[model samples]
Target: MAPSKTFFSNFRLSNIVNLLLRSLQLVDGLVVIGLYGIDLNRARKEDKYSDGKWVYAVTVGSIAAATAVVYAFVSVFMHYRSLTFLFAWDWVLMVLWAALSGIFGTMYLNEKVEMEAGIHRMKVAVGFDLAGLVLWFVTAVMGSLWFFRERWGGRISRPGKA
Candidate 1:
């Protein structure tokens, strides 16, 4: 609720979540400006410059990169603390998250396949698309929670526990 007292505090897990929550405010920005530009360029205008599409892609990329960087910055700042739980699930969750995201992207692309052979009937790739999207959403949420779990000392490690 209150502003952080220092840079390190601003980089805390709760603060990271607050930053992500604030990022929701950019949804309209992405829709209006990033997804479809407001320039006077005619609607009939060819995307020769590809400005709208580029904006869309770049905006998504930037948001993802910024989120990762902010989390990394906070992790670096908290290095002195015994933030060991971060190690327990971070890499595993990160790998799974990446896999799910890749599946989502690939399925999205594959969902548009076209065919012509009469013998080769068509089938909807809807299942893959749905599964991918579901996995992506779950992975994103879990990954974020894992990233911020250390904020409350959610886990404790014994000296000999693995």
Candidate 2:
């Protein structure tokens, strides 16, 4: 009998982290959208900076989420040993995005607080933002370690081998 093909066959811890990252990014996007809607409904006048901040958050979250999902699928489903460069690039980009997301989330929360937005909605948004940031940070660290291992850590020569 032939062994069945399954996702677990090619799965790695990094893949799991990628999936988690994407899921958290998707949730973050949704939460940002919800916050934007609240701001729109409650605003007495247009505030470009406020609206722009939410829009930026939504855009970054969405793009990062989509990229992560696609990368996860490709990394797991495809045999791309010859594409190590691409894989490394993906990890680099994800780490950069995670850092940016964390900074943006913190700034958004601080701005919202200073604006004295509604306590209930602000609190909810803050909670979601923090959760997403934490997830992103974890994914970034995991991805970095995986990339480094692939590139450098695993290169130690065997005891007597050339």
lDDT of each: 0.40, 0.57
Find the 10 residues in a row with the least total lDDT in model 2.
Answer: 79-88
Error of 2 at 138 (Å): 1.4
TM-score of every prediction relative to native: 0.28, 0.59
Query: In candidate 1, how many Å is residue 10 off?
Result: 16
* lDDT tens digits, residue span 1-162, model 2: 334556567666655656656666666756655665566545536544456655555565566556656655665675333234444544444555555456555655555355554755666665666666566566556556655666786486768886
The weakest ten consecutive residues by lDDT in model 1 span 117-126
lDDT for 36 (candidate 2): 50
Q: Write the per-residue lDDT of candidate 1 for residues 1-162, one digit (tens) a residue.
A: 444456456355644553453244233223323222332143437554554443443344344334444444544556412443433333443344345335435534445344543112111222322332343354355445554665655365659886
The list of candidate 2 runs beyond 4 A from truth reads 1-8, 40-50, 79-117, 155-162
Shift in Å, residue 11, candidate 2: 2.7
Which runs in model 1 stand beyond 4 Å of their true positions? 1-47, 79-108, 111-140, 143-162
Candidate 1 collision pairs: none
Error of 2 at 143 (Å): 1.3
